[model samples]
Target: MSVRSLPSPADDPSTDIPPPPEYDGNLPFAAAGPEPARTGGERLYVAMTGAIVAGPFLALGVGGWLLWGRLIHPADLLLALGLYTITGLGVTVGFHRGLTHGSYTARRSVRIALAVAGSMSFQGDVIGWVAIHRRHHAFTDRPGDPHSPYRYGTHLRGQLRGLVHSHVGWLFRNERTPADRYAPDLLADRDIRAVSRAFPALCLLTLALPFGVGWAIGGTWTYALTALLWAGLVRIALLHHVTWSVNSLCHLIGERPFRTHRHDRATNLWPLALLSFGESWHNLHHADPTSARHGVDHGQIDPSAAVIRLLERLGWVRDVRWPTPDRIDARRA
Candidate 1:
């Protein structure tokens, strides 16, 4: 005769319960291998993007040296800064927070403004941008993610490859996120659809507006050209890299103060906090995706949050998802 034995977790293979879908201490990034071979068009697009962005910058440097004092105009500098601020907020507040995450609800007017501003960033059309970003949240750093730096393995070579791929290489890939699946709300809205259709025209307007402003202020074609260079090309390039950094560098470098869904490697990149308009607090973002304020911790300085708060006060936006202490604490690692 023997005493009845108590059943244990290891007693039967079928009895093993899977961890919560959120996280179970599994490492997925390390396991993800290199992505598929990039096509010729993708490579060409990458090359052209590099050339267009870098070309103007090189010209600016060389021209600045040749015409140092002439190139350094107060009006040009201010114009660039102004466009950067307006357009950057449009993406952060309008595209990423409002449209993509529904972090806050905005009036139709506010929504249109944000959509237009985000388009000024020249990333993509509102519908497509929201779809891709929404898909990013849905898949994160997992295999299905469109731009995870860890698409390649976690080894040194793989990390480097992943970094480049995530930074700007993935843009060349022809695979687009399905707007129908990821952004049904945007698709249904007539205003959003109209904006999507006019993205190409808006891209031109963003540049033209700056040039016109410069021409009017300085009363010269030279000034208009310079503003086009600085405020249009250079500013777009800078903003592009900063936003892309949130995708690439934030995943690979910076602090992971909060734990996110399983295998998500988003980190709070402080150096980019200001430039990215508080988007660099990416770890907190992934941890609490619905929270409007990404830079939740003390002294985090989230300008986008501030803008949202202003909009809330002005009655332009409603249902702002400001983070609560309990919510923040729950996501802490």
Candidate 2:
């Protein structure tokens, strides 16, 4: 006996459900909200900038003249360089890699060390830095991005203006990224909360530590003062620009070899490779968000990755997601 096919949903018009509402594909532009009232931190950052400018000039004019009239010591320069390198790495490896990305898990002692060292950078508390960084990744190059070099219209002058805005002007602006939305995890952590609260004390120590070291090493107040000037103030200013470059210059320039869903203009600028501790490998980072290592390829010098590897070997960190050839191939543009 011949059998007939039962009616399908498409054949039965009455049984059909209405199609879901069509998205126009145009994302609604979020309105610029009322300017936020400045916080103590905001005022502090401004005051610090002013102090950095004036302090250096005054030191050069008065202190430098006095020291020059007497004699210049080599030990002072060594102390400055040493302190700058250590503290700068603390911000880069501790704040950027370990805290912000969770590239690898560290032991309690390591975690505390990283947190304390990062705090010494005076960039802000760990939570604040991570919050703003997460927001930067979330919005990137778009209107809501914290420091997109493309904020202004695409013109020679506009891009130049935008670059300057991205580099340092964005920090001076009163807008604050919502900590609850971007960094709830950090805010909830007791250790992080305590460390963040102790930021004022950390800032004082950051400046003082260099001076103390210089005095102990050279046995002179003049040497300690010079160390403080170079290591404390100048180092911070230099690192600030290096970190900011990843936001402004990395986006606007560099090669985009990997595909991305977001309007992320991040690139791997080799020039900033060593200084940024392999953070210049931005394209791969955006491609594989959770990967522990950014500098995946051979001949790419990633000091941070080396540090992580050493930590893993020492059993201080585990579950590192190093890049595989297959994964790299998959992300290839």
Per-residue CA lDDT of model 1 for 1-333, tens digit only, reads 000121211222332334346432332343335676768877886686676456645755755663565674777778889999999999999998888777888898999999999998888899999888876776677666789887776778878898998988877664668888667778888998999999989988999997999899889998888888888877888898899999999999999999776667899989999999999999999887767999988899899999999999999988887899998998899
Model 2 lDDT per residue over 1-333, tens place: 000121211223342333223311123223377767768987897788667444544555554565677644566567656665666667766776677666667777887788888888767888898778766766556666778777674577768888988887787774678888667777767788898999889989988987887788778887787777666666666566677788888887888888654456788888988888788888888777556788887777887788879889999977676878999989988
Q: Which candidate has the highest TM-score of all?
A: 1
TM-score attained by model 2: 0.82
* Candidate 2 least-lDDT 10 residues: 1-10
Q: What's the lDDT for residue 43 in model 2?
A: 86
